[model samples]
Target: MFDKNHPHLFGRLITFIFAFWLIIGIALFSLNDTPAEINQAKAQTINNVGAYFWAGNVKDLGGGFIKTGETLLEGLGSSIIRISMSPRFRIDYNLGGGCISNFSLETLAKGPDLNPILTNPSFSTIIITAYDGTSFSDCETKNYLYPDLYTPEITAAIEQEYKALAQYLGTIKGKTFIILNWEGDNDIYCGTAYGATANSCPNYQKHIEGFTKWINARTKGIKSAGVGNVYSGVEFNIVRYLKNAGLPSILYDVIPNVAADYFSYSSYESINELYSGDNGTKLLSDITTAKSAISAGGGNNSNFIIGEYGFETLGREDSKNKLETVTNLLHSRGVRYAIVWNLLDSGGGFGLYDSNAVLTPSGKYVCSLYQGSACFIIQSPSSTPTPAITQTPKPTTTTVPTNNPCAPTSGFASSCIEDGTKIITVAPPNISNSNLNLTISIDIPANKNSVIWPTGYYWSATLKNWAPFTLQGNNYPGSSWLVNSASTTLSVPYSNLQPGINYIVTWDYIWDGSKWLGPPCSTLTNSLCWRLETFIRP
Candidate 1:
């Protein structure tokens, strides 16, 4: 009531209004600064992230299959539930029941029943590994030598039980990834000492045959049962060097025969290699080799799955950084999915979370990548004004040479030698002009099981390295540059060819879903060059 119209009161009121508006304006600016979405492409990148979880049973909270009311299982589920609530994160449920004996097939069959929570709409996909307690090395011994344990009748019974489990899984209407047997190679290689006696030792070939039979039977049973919305595959440990080089029991022999929708391999090399300062080059090479083998075996259409990968460094920060680096590497390589090895650190050191369901450092980093925040967001000045969006300019097309001189040379080294019928030809090897036009033609074998595509490699004399050529052609849909035809001819132009220096142009082919197969043109192989050339002035 004091001086309502007084000059001093009016001035004070005006001052109060100005200060209030200024505070509100500053808050609005702060709110706007709270990390805007960087781009739409990054937002979609987090969709398929997943992890593995195993909750202990009642008797042992740290080990044992899931039993209702088990505190560990409940805690594990709670963690999964929390992760599921996070956008773009899913849980990979390892069916512990499979680890039990065949006598408990029915109990194992109930494993899916225990995951009712996973069926919720929030969970977009479920990846279940149906473990068969029999390890790969034990496959031949248990199924053949030990007749009492797995007789013909008993094997048939086990097949039927797996079929039942598959049928149950198919009933759930969502994208589902099922690994029929996890790490079958381990059973063959790890369970037995190398060079042990025949009876007690691992018969690598026999083990492969037995594993193939088991996989085929299980695959057929699941298919015959009409499992819908399910992608099935068998998981193998990364191929051992000796096993791949000399054994007939390789993945190439097994995968093509079975009707697997995809192939999966577990990679733990990064765990040891990361600390030594290797940034997944070894892991990537392994993956490339595996894909090449699979594709050579005619599993061209099969996608790849990184069934398991994890790391545990000396410090939590180190572990988190490693996780971020490797996960990004996997995603960039066209891997369909990567499930972290374990959700809880079982005291052996790879778990993303502690036993108490709290996220460890690696887990937090993983969670951030999945949520599209820690990896995707770009921090900006809170006070910077938002820029106006502009239309993107259309790319201009460059005209490439249609004719090139190339000739096949015997001196060229290649990891994969060309089959006699499938030849790589480069025309007019010795060239004088700087605008070196090269044409490469590949004769696709009529019985070629895989879709063949053209890929070229050129040796950089100056750089002393072999660099891959950028092919010009219609890319196979959804693939980088792979094609789905019988034969392909590519014209390459090298305008930067150095005079008086020898250069090599190596022709190669990539079978769909695999690495370069016909020739190893890059530094990946030490084989003698198969395509050699020198550009000289006339």
Candidate 2:
């Protein structure tokens, strides 16, 4: 017992005892930890991510078409997931080509419903676009608008299904929210196609009435579930609301009529209004105006959310910077969530990643945010080399007769003028609130036949669509003001303007004889040949 190995036995026993106590101490310390503290240890951060109409192709499983939602949810790294399903899930309405028709909705409504997304523990927020009819052409031709799919049976089915969904959402641990919405303003409820003027798009009046009832039914259904975790929302393209001052605007027309819990803005125009390296001036102004509009329409502005925002063909570097800038500004404005347009490139070029699985600069930044890692800095592009100047003989310009009241003036109306035989200006010089009090000025040379007064068409660069207007008291399209008159000014009070975005108003005039009496500006691409005025709302 006095051997060297035998003498160390007591010391070895003490060392073993110390290791056991150390393990026990660590376990006891963990007992007092919060979920957040444990998540911090695992480096889990909050992620609000969504896709645009993409849940991958569903597989035909004979009984019904279904997909293992987990496969796609695994690497998404999102705390919120957005998916879409066609309204014609139970029965085909023959809604035509552009409409999204599949069994995804039925599968969600029946067995294994909501489980596709809820089973994935990583996601706490779920947004479902229950109606995916996004065809403007179909709206014109077949009247394939949101109202077309609504019926007594469909409404009941929607209510029953969402009730089940809400009940399930209530059982999820921690804070969870589910939002249900439809196609939004993507369908052309108001525009030139239906000859929509400021007062009416008469042909689609039934559609609007039907839509209001349909939306109310949907919200009622969601509320019937009696769960606080579920909310009803309506998506509106704020840009469209601003551009088209005519009928069928969800923000102005439908929202006030429905009982939606939140307003989601598909904000494409907001992205277009941003300048490089913006310090949140334009973006914040747009959001503020949008909130005011929502509030005025009786919607809860505090619940405003960005349903969609993205950039395509802006190059990955610029897109990344723009997206990051927008997100930071939205966060500053106290927005709870925002969904990028899509995850994978599906030809619109709005995807975070390309078809080949290559991560775009924007995608990389988003991924970093999801993973709680610092984003890689995208270097600004180098300035292009300026071309050397070359001297050439100057061509002589002929002097034209003057009396152009539409001449460019200083300050707010600096860029309001367009000159020719007939001159035009959208607003008189140096005046604010020009958009609200829209003014169009024109002058014609003396000793000419009486000129046709101009009719206004509002152009939305984002939608590449024109909203044609009829002069007050006129029911026909292409209605003009002060016909067979010259050298006059016309002012109309327009109250539906959304400020902080540039608007292009093209006034068509048949000059003493302007170029070949071209088709209406809405149908033609040569917008420059027409008398146009562009201005930003102050």
Clash number for every model?
A: 19, 0
The sequence of per-residue lDDT tens digits that candidate 2 reaches over residues 463-513 is 444444433221111112233233323332333333333333333233333
For model 2, the superposed segments whose C-alpha errors exceed 4 Å read 1-76, 87-106, 109-114, 132-158, 168-177, 188-202, 239-248, 275-280, 372-538
Ten residues in sequence with the least summed lDDT for candidate 1: 384-393
Per-model TM-score on C-alpha atoms: 0.50, 0.49
User: Quick one: best lDDT, which candidate?
Assistant: 2
Off by over 4 Å in 1: 1-44, 55-113, 132-155, 192-200, 243-245, 248-250, 300-302, 372-538
Candidate no. 1 TM-score: 0.50
Tell me which residue pairs clash in candidate 2. none
lDDT of 1 by residue, 176-234 (tens): 63644555555554353222233554466666666677776667666666777655577
For each candidate in turn, give its C-alpha RMSD to the true structure in angstroms. Answer: 27.1, 28.2
What is candidate 2's TM-score against the reference?
0.49
